[model samples]
Target: MLLLVSLFGCVAAVGAVGTHARLSPEAILPASAESVRAEAVLVSRFGAGEPHLMLLATTSGSVDGQRAATSGRDLTDRLAADPRTAWVRSYWPRHPAGLRTADRHRALILVRFRGDERASRAAGDDVVARYTGRAGPLRVSAAGTFAVLSESDRLSERGLHLAEIVAMPLVLLVLLWTFGSAVAALIPVAVGVLAVVSTTAFLRLLTEVTTVSAFALNITTALGFGLAVDYCLLLVSRFREELAREGSTGPAVRATLRTAGRAVAFSGAIVAVCLCTLFVLPLPLVRSIAYGGVAVVLASVAGVLLVVPALLVLLGERVNRLDVFVRLRPRKRTRSAEGAGAWYRLALWVTRRPAAVAVGVLLLLGLLAAPAALTRFGMYGDRLLPHFSPVARTSQEVRAAFAATVSDRPSVVLLGPGAARSAEAVDGFARRLSRVPGVRRVDTVTGAYRQGRRSALPPGPAERFTVGGATRLSVVPATGPAPQDGLTPEGSRLAARLRAVPAPVPVLVGGAGARLNDVEGVLADRLPPAVGFAASATFVLLLVFTRSLLIPVKALLLNALSLMATFGLLVAVFQEGWPAGVFFGPRGAGVTDVIAPLMFAVAFGLSMDYEMFLLSRIVEEHRRGASTPTAVATGLQHSGRLFTSAAVVFATVTASLALSDLLHLQVVGTGLAVAVLLDCTVIRALLVPALMQLVGRANWWLPGARTKDRGQERKTGRARTP
Candidate 1:
């Protein structure tokens, strides 16, 4: 066993190196979407794509001043000269109003880097490194899709490292306190390390076949560590309990594997199945997370079920060595006396006043969930980064200084054969597009049009629009606050309006705005089926595990309620920015990140994790001839502290993400932390017990299963009571 573990560890260590380099930082849009198609044509035919880098050059005087103009031209020339640049468009020499700030003290330089997404980001990093800071007469700052994403990736990596630094010691402390022995505490940590390492290696290999998000690393580390510890907590605790009962290492190991090992397997499968629901969403970010999450779950389960039992066998009674917290640990109690503990007492109280407890907890959860109704979903932008982030600050400056610019403008690609030859048709379409409400101008192969009139003949390069029988039109949005990658509400409205306009030929509308609409549409179409599938699978799994119909239904309802409350809290904290000083996240962007769906799937799975822990124990007790109330209390006594410790450790791991400057990470961290805490304390502890008590024998009812004998219930009723 030691040799096998060591060999696997060595391979994992080798593979994990430079894993992040193989992962993508770019957002993956659906290829089936028209916008994506247009983008493909634009890149393939026109040698142009969305600007990957934006340089904001600010001057003390008007940007059009001779000195500033010369510097800007020099800056643009320098950018254009770079071999990495595909193209560079600037406000220098000929100042377009949209490219210059209203005060004329700042100008925009848009640059598209050559090559693929990763190469573009690399180019952006190089450009920012070389061109940022003061030039002769201007101060240049960089912000664009690539720049922002690059910064986010850097921050995310750093945040993950920081979280590890913060979470590990805290996890060890929790384990030590829970096990009352440093030796036992280190066992879970070792399992966690093994799981993380193994999953990291799996992700590295996964990247070789398909695109995976760099963000997957974050989830891999957090979930791998957390779930490993959680499963180990169950196994280690069960083994200890069985050790005392069986009075032999081999028997205790066997018993522990029979009970906790089975629960861990079921729990891991459920979590993995839940994460697989992300596959229904046509987004690589979520899909990558699904892949990483499943891998982590499998690795953690394997380590706990295979490696942990081996370690326990080897250590035997020595597992209790290094009793650092022995003084603080409670004395061992008889099975009957164990029911007198805090968790058991609380369970009894909840069962005694089941109706009142149920109603009160439901009310609290409802109130917490109220804010979810107000959630507005939108794609995030540089504003999702810290205010001090260079890209974020540059983006803010651009929005404040300029109105609409080429970067935020939607592009229309006419793709049918002979489309470019239809001059009159193209002219009519361009005029109609310009006439749309909120459209500032339309630049096409023929000329620039404004408000249904031809304003000017093609100014820069007509070849940019007409290439290989395809004609492109750039629809400049009206002057306003910058749309976040053209994915804001206003941007979506504009895209919809433009799409509604009559076209002379088959046209594909493409831009961040059009892409946002496409993405939202896909989610709307796919989300229902995905959710139904996950729910059905979970229900079936629970039913098979518990052999109880009402229990599965109850678990589903409780998980949904907990998730809704968690979403509400996310909306309130991240979107509404309530109690802004607490999380230290960026100011609210007025809408929740589109990542909410992903968060929902993840949190729901994790909530069910704790649910499975509690239910497994309760079912164990009930099958042992305990009455409903006694089973509930005894189950709490057996598994409550174990899962609660697991929740705390998991919460600690995820909550450390709040320290990240990336708002998306902060949202994930804070949301999961709250979800786990609420699940363990309010939902699992109070509500589950209360609801189970109210349901009575129905909680254990299974189809075609004989009801418990009345005489046996009567026989065990008194003996089971605490």
Candidate 2:
């Protein structure tokens, strides 16, 4: 009853808070008056189209997604009633479209706004008031990328219910089929589910301060289902072996807990640690992942270490055996999923020649990753929605029409302060900027300066007043064919020239383009740390698991190769735009964004997960006095097929996310799927075995370093020495 009450409390709190915060842009952005330019620049270029960001809020489903969206719409209608809002109305949709995913209770509505943040947010707040409860029992609010930063938190909330409904059954059925058991197999999962559900409720408390992205739904669900299923599988499989020997559930469960449980606890700790690395950056998105990751992992550990044993105590003999899958196959064949015995022989050949296998695998990854190099890092927003999407189509038309009216298309701001109200100072700066080559036009406060529109944000005196008031001058660059952020030489050149401005006015430049440039810088600075930290941690985890420092180092080295080769290829393909978007699937990138490093790091971390999982069994056999060759063969035979299936599952789910209308998610999902499939097949099967074989025992031994430790084998023989 207490548990039930707690659950009810959580649900109630989520609804109460969720309604006001879902998909709220106000939640995510660093709100400062000075930061308004980041929001304003786009509004200036897009005109009324800038308000389109609000659509993400409307579409996000919470207690009142529809009602909140309706409020935004109604406010828009009122705003349209004024002459000043005539242009804003042009971009406003009477009723925005809402997205319906697997569940219909959820939905999304799209909208647009004007100016930068000031104009847009002022408008957004009006829409928000109607949806923020107080009006009635229903608190209406949208949640998504732009509408809510807390969208992630809402997504976390969404996943809480989803874990029980979707993931639980799915995990149960999958485990039942995999284990062919009743209580023995399902008990661990039951424990894991309860623990994770409880932990997620705790996660809600975090929403008070930190922003959570909706994507966290995937994170927790994946962690909960994955760690639960994996732990239970390992424990129960061990129990089955022990049960046949001890002929008792209590002893078998105890034995399984002693061994597999220890491994699970250690492994879960490492994974939890690994995930915490995401918090190395100051970015809230990554930090949110850390919090969510830690909670689920801790829950998983608790389930495996505590709950499973309790379950065993309760269920007693019933927990010892079963037939969930009703299979007629012999039990011996069941233990070995892949044809790994044969592959083991193949691994021997590669062990004899590590360089050849390593090189071959590197070549393949290099080729596949080639497209990533030429990829452009663009925002995967509604803007990238199919050219036919209402907003996309509208934007295209708007862009074309504006091209005729304005001298410049949507572009950049290269800013510096100017000298007084002197027309000469503004004129000289404009003349120099106009001659800066890539610049289309350089407008100043001077009467002679012309293109269109009078200057409210003019140069000289206006710029001076701005400086005294913590404001600065802005020089808008031509849209042209330049890279989105300052990635290219042209962008670099523009930035450099603007920074060289001689006027006394203080200069601080930012826009979508500039912030994006900063985003890249942040990634570059943080990625190396992430790589070194994650890789070192992985190595330590493997070392402890195998009790062989060399083996862990080899794995680390191979992971490095896979990661770097992929990065090189990403640069070659995505950054360079090789094959011009063919490899990228439908939408082509001209130049990849800085987000790639973070994404790549994340992909590599997950790839490490499969590597650790599939290979641990083989390493275990080898440690138990099986010949290295025999161990490889037996281990692969046991876990190979399962690894492949899991990889495919991960890939398939990730692929589904790619189908999202949002380009950002689509790009992320695409890259993740590619990495997983590659790791599972080429990296896991062929290259890893081949490389390990070539290294022989050296794969698990550091050169010039050998402790005469217990269970030490001098060579590859079956004999072990203490």
Q: What range of 10 consecutive residues in model 1 has the weakest lDDT sum?
A: 705-714
What's the alpha carbon RMSD for model 2? 9.7
Best by lDDT: 1
Error of 2 at 134 (Å): 30
> Tens digit of lDDT per residue, candidate 1, span 602-699?
77878888887888888887776788998889888888998899889889988989988888888889988998899999999999999999889888
* Residue range 529-639, candidate 2, lDDT tens digits: 976787788778777777676677766766666665656655554345445355444444445544445555446555666676556777667666665656666666555
The global Cα lDDT (0 to 1) of model 1 is 0.84
Candidate topping TM-score: 1
Candidate lDDT values, in order: 0.84, 0.53
Per-residue error (Å), model 1, residue 84: 1.4
